[model samples]
Target: MKKWALFLLMFLLFILLACNDEETNEHVSSDQEEHEKPEVRTTPSESSKPKTKPLPEMTWEHLVNQEEGKLTANLDVDEKMSDQLVETLEKEITALTDETNDPEQIYRGAVDLLASSYYQTYFEKASTYDPDFEEPYLPDPEIEKKEGKKASPKKAFILLDASSSMLLRVNGKIKMDIAKNAVQRFGEVIGQDSDLSLLVYGHLGSESSEDKQLSCEGIEEVYEMSPYDEETFQASLNSFESKGWTPLAGAIKEAANMSRDFTEDVTVYVVSDGVETCGGDPVAAAEAFTKDSKERKVHIIGFHVDETAENELKKVSDAGNGTYYPADNEEELQDTIQKRWLPSLADLAWAHTKAPGPWEVLGKLEELEKHTNKLTEVRQLETERLNTVYRLIRDHDLLSSEAREDLKALLDERDDEIRTLIKNLTDEKKEDINKQADDIKNRVSEWRDRMYELRDEERDHS
Candidate 1:
């Protein structure tokens, strides 16, 4: 019985100790939940990197207007480095040929030199800024500019020199008659819906010394600036006779004066038979006429002009950014007007995009074409350098014959990648330009429509 009681006492003590141990474990677990943590393995991609090292990143500053803040960028391109390019290309090719005869290595090394990034120190994007290759100092393609919103209209201006030279006969008809006929036909086509004007100079006084001052000063606008009307235009053409001194420069100056205020483009056609007889700088006048306007052309047609006259007229045309056509006879004059001049005028009017004015109509297109030139140059230069390296390896008998084919295939692959890049970039530029153009057009159309409605409302009130 004593043994049994001892056993029960021991068992109760053990049970109490077990309960204390369980409570202690529960307390430790609660503390652990409050303060302590468990460890876990993490992947490199999922973890945060150390800030000590930074990766290279590209910068972009989109175009900003009044709403968005402006941002500036470096406009100047690096100095030309063709010499450096040649030298470096040679060095790289030589190194590749000497170090390894593998055509793949040589090709890749050559390609690295041709990369756009590699040329950051040489040319910037300015190397391909101008498609014509004449204007090299143009602004960089990355220039930030607001979307253009100016509308362009096509207008035609005919400058008829009615000096006594027009009195001279050609073939069976008078030169004046031929010129008048051509002008009438041109009006029929160009003035179908477009604005047209006819200005006659040197038609009041005789083409003599005594009347030189009067003839030079006498300038008449036979037809006012408006759409062509057959009856009115014919009457205006017959308003004056051909008898006066040639005031070519004065006529150009006056035309320019008339065109200065017009937001629309004025294409001028000058019909003359001689140089400036009144001692005026026709060249300077032509230059100024085209300088301040949107897109003015001064096409000069010479009628039986001497070499000196042709030369002078050619200069004037060149200054005006136009072509000079020399017609020796009546048939030649008519043919020039019918075939070359008239067709060109109609085409010009047709080809002219009726959109917002002067935001570089061919901006992205020009850049795109120019970029191809640069890429072509890059490809040529890369291939040339690689070929040199390949030849060296071939001469030294260092590489297998199969290396040639392998290098060629690699070059082709690189070129394919470049082509893909060009396509993608082109698509992006085209989409952006088209969107901007469309936006401007729609906005302008709405504004003009609203303006017309308001004007009509005012008229009704009146």
Candidate 2:
């Protein structure tokens, strides 16, 4: 009777040990079910339920100009960077989880690691990176706006709305102060050979009905219509404050009047935080500016605006045959001013230079393609780094066979995601490049026709 009892006790103990060793795995949703919440994981075995530490952080930054769209990545596997990736992964396994460790937990972490917000940082900064690196960056290579030494550089007539709304603080700084910095920085850039004229509206009176007439009629060229002079521009920027109502229509009309006599093409940039509170038709005024001067282009930057104000600003830009840029911060504001088409065609001496516009534009496109090529290297490098870390862990038997396989799958999945992002972004940028190229081609064609007409008239008169 005693021996039978002992045998039964040993059998029960054996069953208990077996049950404890049966590890449960965590399940992550595949691509098709990505949006759905991850299903609850089975109860992990005592040996598999290890304490997890937070994952390592990864970031991508611009190694070049945003217009170049170049991103930095370590393809050859930097030991320091890889080491951080490994330590985070190591915490997910337990003392008893050796060669028999299941893959589910490690995989879930891998999915989170790939979806890290750091990956999206590139896009955030890329917005200011020159989304519409328009006609000025490289210019329409064929048309020349600067014809002689006496000819002035293309004019950049910048309009500022000094309505009381601009006094609102953002990130601890007043919006007017921020705009001042952006405008000054924009004026400081040389070699573009563009003269900058600073204009401000609604800077004269308070936002009271008694002062409404004063504010609405207030439009002043604080910075004279001259080449960018840092000291003078600074003084001009200091001359205004966020004091009154928004006279958007009056501002546009004033800009048109200022540039009416400019023989070369002109670009007008209006920076405002609100719409036309003065009850004027801003869109029509912009349209008239473009109509009166064929070479004039109008652009608007909505600074810290709501949806309604943005919509109205868009209409103004559209009517003026220009684009609308929204800037919530100083960096974006500066980028909006500096990054649109550089002094390309306007700076090119027109005295003896002319080329087929489309070909020149295509040539510039190649430079962009070369810049984008750097993205392909990101996939190859990240995959290699993951494989290296995996092999190191596998050879040392850090995780069970199943976990190793799952990690490999996770690595592959992450690599695919990075590739897809690169492809999509590249395609979008290429489309934009094509559109800008078409625009340049149109401008060049128009200029050629105008020149021919002028030449024929000269001959007829002679």
Candidate 3:
């Protein structure tokens, strides 16, 4: 019995020993498996890489240079993250390029971008404001060479009628307010080369002083055409409010001094709702003004006016040797002024009427008119085509598969009509352009003849 007990104890001890050994080996293997792969200590300096190229210093010349490589460099922006930044950069560049001659303005404009939406977020997070954050200035673009160099700055009188009629509401805002907004928008589009004057009529009360009345007349106490700076112009626009009658003729006559400046062509833009309150023929006044000087041309735009007003406005345009624009609404008014008037005026300014310069001012005017006609025709065709498609699509019944197919056929037909219209319009424009080219050639020949005649006269005098 003693031998049996001793043997059993020895067997149990051996089994326990084997089990303990196995547990120790398993723990060691598990630990080895957990730490077998290499440990990675990723520091930010190694992981967050820097860009290969440094950001370029913003300069006017660098930004505006149309050269492919230079443009690419200036435009090589991180489009995904920096659309606003890109816009800001472009605006700064344009503003700088435009106002290069004004050193103080250039300085202000350069830093203005830092205050823009793009940079504001970064700036707000900054601990301090840097007073010395000035961008390096660059010289202007080489003034483009021309046959006749004329850089005349034009003065334009914008006589906006802020009458009671304009006070009527449209599109969730008063018409006068909308007009005010539109004018403000136009101010933004106007070139640095021109000076603009803001005069609002019908805002004066009945018992107002002579000074106030004169101020509104485009003459009397007139706010003369001056440089387009934000503060003064914006103040004038903001202060304008509707009050009195539409004195259309008196306004034109008041601006007649503008006609006297033969050196610079004066343009008058009369923005009105088109009812003559103190009835004197505005057209007659315009005719008289043009006849007297033959230098000034007045443009009349009827802003959301009645049919009678439009007809009268057209007459005034004819009398003034100008174009009548019926800006039926705010959007049309905006488009008319920016896309047509401002650019035309800017080009005229480059003619420099100050001296007997060789700039083809008349030719430019004609070209502008032609461009307007072409654009108008194109727009009309496009609008007509769109309307036709819209009508067809909206009215077409598609209950059955056959009806659906029929509607599709109609859409195809409209598409064909649109294509035909486009082709016809394009061809017409081409022919018109060719005719204009021939006319220009003739005019050049005539001008050459006149020049030769003058030379002959000079020779005889000598």
* lDDT of candidates 1 onward, in order: 0.65, 0.66, 0.54
Stretch of 10 with least lDDT, candidate 1: 63-72
In model 3, how many backbone clashes occur?
Answer: 3
TM agreement with the true structure for every prediction? 0.41, 0.42, 0.39
Give one digit per residue, the lDDT tens place, for model 3 in 332-448. Answer: 776666431212334334322322222343443344444334433433433343233223323442123443344345435534653454355445544554555445445544444
lDDT of 3 at 52: 39
Extract clashing residue pairs from model 2.
75-381, 99-400, 136-341, 136-342, 137-341, 137-342
Local error of candidate 1 at residue 383 (angstroms): 99
Tens-place lDDT per residue, model 2, 1-462, is: 999999999999999887666532112325346667578857678886777554333223421222211111321322224465555445433322442354545444333332222233344443223333323222221232232112223788889889999999989889998888776766655224677888899898899999999999999999887777767888889877889999999998998887777787787888899999999999999999999665677888899899999999999999988889899887677656544222323433341233335556566556555545545554455466456546766877777676688778867766776677667666777677677666655665665555455556657989
Predicted model with the maximum lDDT: 2
- Residue 398 lDDT (model 1): 55
Backbone atom clashes (below 3 Å) for every candidate: 2, 6, 3
Instruction: For candidate 1, write residues 141-203 as lDDT tens digits.
Output: 111112231221267788998999888887767888878877776565567546888998989
Q: TM-score of model 2 relative to the true fold?
A: 0.42
Query: What are the runs in model 2 whose C-alpha is more than 4 Å off?
Result: 1-153, 340-462
